[model samples]
Target: MGIIKLTNIRVYAYHGCLVEEGKIGSDYRVDVSVKANLQPSAGTDNLKDTVDYVHINRIVKEEMAIRSKLLEHVSKRILDRIFNEIPIAEEATVEVSKINPPIGGNVEMVTIEMTLHRHNHKQQSEL
Candidate 1:
């Protein structure tokens, strides 16, 4: 097993409970990490044999574009799409951060993180 991580993906999005946040938007940083079998791709040097980082980036961008009240909601959506779209991804974790959040006080950011395993999803589906 191996991990592929895409870090500090910057995006401008409107995701917050505040009305002004929806209208003006804010800067967001997204990080995604996926684990999969890398032996095949490592040996063959073929893109198809591994979890594609480009696809993961696209998923993050697409999901972040949608408006949501909380970072947890967006984080879950990102994880769900990673498992559903990338079959080779055995597990994934996503971190969504809102830079300079409006929660008062001197805070750098507010972040929401979520992790999902493919097996867990399958088990849930079977129930």
Candidate 2:
């Protein structure tokens, strides 16, 4: 088992609990960690054997484009997409940070992080 990390992907998106935030939008930074069997891809150097990071990035971007009321929802969407679309991924962690959040005070950002295991997620949901 090996880990693939993609960090600090910046995106401008409209996602917030507040109405103004959704209207104006804000900058967001996303980080994703994927755990999988990377040995085959490492040896064969084939894109098909491993998770395509470019495809993951595209997923993140696509999810960010949609409006959400909370960062937690955004992160969940990203994690779900990664696990469902990337067959090689056994687990995934996603972090979504809203830069300069509108908290009416001095705050740099707020981030939501979620981790999901393929087997546990399905079982937990069914219960």
Instruction: Name the candidate that leads on TM-score.
Output: 1
Q: Candidate 2: list runs displaced more than 4 Å.
A: 124-127
Q: TM-score for all predictions?
A: 0.95, 0.95
Give the alpha carbon lDDT tens digit for every residue of 1-127 in model 2.
9998999999999998888988899999999999999999999999999988999999999999999998898898898888778988999999999998888899898889999998976786689
Model 1, residue 9: displacement in angstroms? Answer: 0.4
Report each candidate's C-alpha RMSD, comma-separated, in the order given: 1.1, 1.2
Q: Residue-wise lDDT of candidate 1 within 1-114, one digit each (tens)?
A: 999999999999999999999999999999999999999999999999999999999999999999999999999889888889888999999999999998878889888988
lDDT of 1: 0.93
The numbered model that scores best in lDDT is 1
RMSD of 1: 1.1
In candidate 1, position 125 carries an lDDT of 65
